[model samples]
Target: MKLIDITNNHPKLVNEQLSNTDAQMVKVYSLGQTTVIYTIAPTHKDLVIINPKRPIRDNEIDYVLQRTIKAPLQSLEVTHVGNFVEITQSLKKKRPTFVPRFS
Candidate 1:
């Protein structure tokens, strides 16, 4: 996915993009590296999440599963809904143990 494409097609992602909060480092799997994207929360400022490494492939998804089982960060799916792109974290399964939980 190209940055221009994302920006043009999915304005929501770019509009909601945010900088990393908290000093702690978070490990996330690459979805499709093109550029950064963002989302708007009901409350608080927009949140930005990193795009998966460029050229998302089956192998990359496999690598994410393998590594995540060992160490996981919250996983989110980026999808386009009509004219807007939405970023949603999957609740299908538990996040990796290494992932920090908010109290």
Candidate 2:
């Protein structure tokens, strides 16, 4: 999914779109090369968002999000969000962690 680079433009429109939908909670999934976000709103369809540019690293996630969403990550009241590595690890845990030993 191609994310329109709104860091330099259209920040207001994007904000309005998100706000109008009343989607405050979002679930995020990170594939190897990109990230996917699902906005949860009972009144509207879940908004699936990919990245705006290249895959954002954990260290720079805050900066990238601030630029793209035009709001500081802290102020977004974001909690219970999982990053790529975290989700991946959790998935791994749920699967059977056994190796076949053919004698």
Candidate 3:
């Protein structure tokens, strides 16, 4: 008989699409400084929808983006999240050329 070792793998995410029909409760990671919650969608899911605990203004896009992403994601323009052509096109259309800074 042959067996495999899955000890080093960390089950930090909730993969609903891949879960067996038996598992139920799961842990939520709260190590971030923002005190925000991130409910990761399952493996088959395409988005990590955020329903902020408090009200947020649409004009706060820049502030929210800056706080959410510590560094520029320029490198990902050709890969990763930007790899989706349709999404890139949509962002290009909705995004403004100049982004105003807030105090």
Candidate 4:
């Protein structure tokens, strides 16, 4: 039997793309050569599609979400395509309880 640890081997994101309009907003983060699209709808949950402009690992999806989204995700749904993956997470919007006052 052979086992491998692949959690720490994914590429890190170096840049991001933000698009905003009246209809909806889109956020795209690029990890090295791979690109992942993350969309959050006001009426629905957030969606993350890993189309992988290049090769991408599954754990990288988690990394992107952790870095981008401030809200904790709930009811996660992950779908694996031929060579990519899609992740859906319902975000509970919460107002920040603490506001720092810089003097």
Q: After superposition, how far is residue 83 of candidate 3 from its true place, in Å?
A: 19
Cα lDDT tens digits, model 1, 1-103, are 2222244665343333434432122222224552333333333222133334334343433344343332232354544333233344433445667967899
Instruction: Give the runs in model 4 whose Cα sits over 4 Å from its true position.
Output: 1-23, 51-55, 70-74, 91-103
List per-candidate RMSD values in Å: 11.9, 16.0, 18.6, 9.9
lDDT of 3 by residue, 1-103 (tens): 1112221242544455228522333322221221122222222112121223533223232233344323343422211222111001112224547988999
Single out the weakest 10-residue window by summed lDDT for candidate 2: 84-93
Best by the lDDT measure = 4
In model 3, which range of ten residues has the least summed lDDT? 82-91
Better-scoring candidate (TM-score), 2 or 4: 4
Question: What are the per-residue Cα lDDT tens digits for candidate 4 across 1-103?
Answer: 1122222343232122223322144555556555555555654444444444544465666676576554443456767665576666554667769988999
Q: If the candidates were sorted by their TM-score against the true structure, best first, what order would they fall in?
A: 4, 2, 1, 3
Candidate 3: where is the Cα deviation over 4 Å?
1-61, 77-103
Query: Best-fitting candidate, measured by TM-score?
Result: 4
TM-score-wise, the better of 1 and 2 is 2
Cα lDDT tens digits for candidate 2, 1-103: 2333333344464466567866655544444345545454444323233445554455445443543445444444333333331111011124557989998
Better of 1 and 4 by lDDT: 4
lDDT of residue 83 for candidate 4 = 51
> Distance from true position, residue 45, model 4, in Å?
3.7
Error of 3 at 85 (Å): 12
lDDT of 2: 0.42
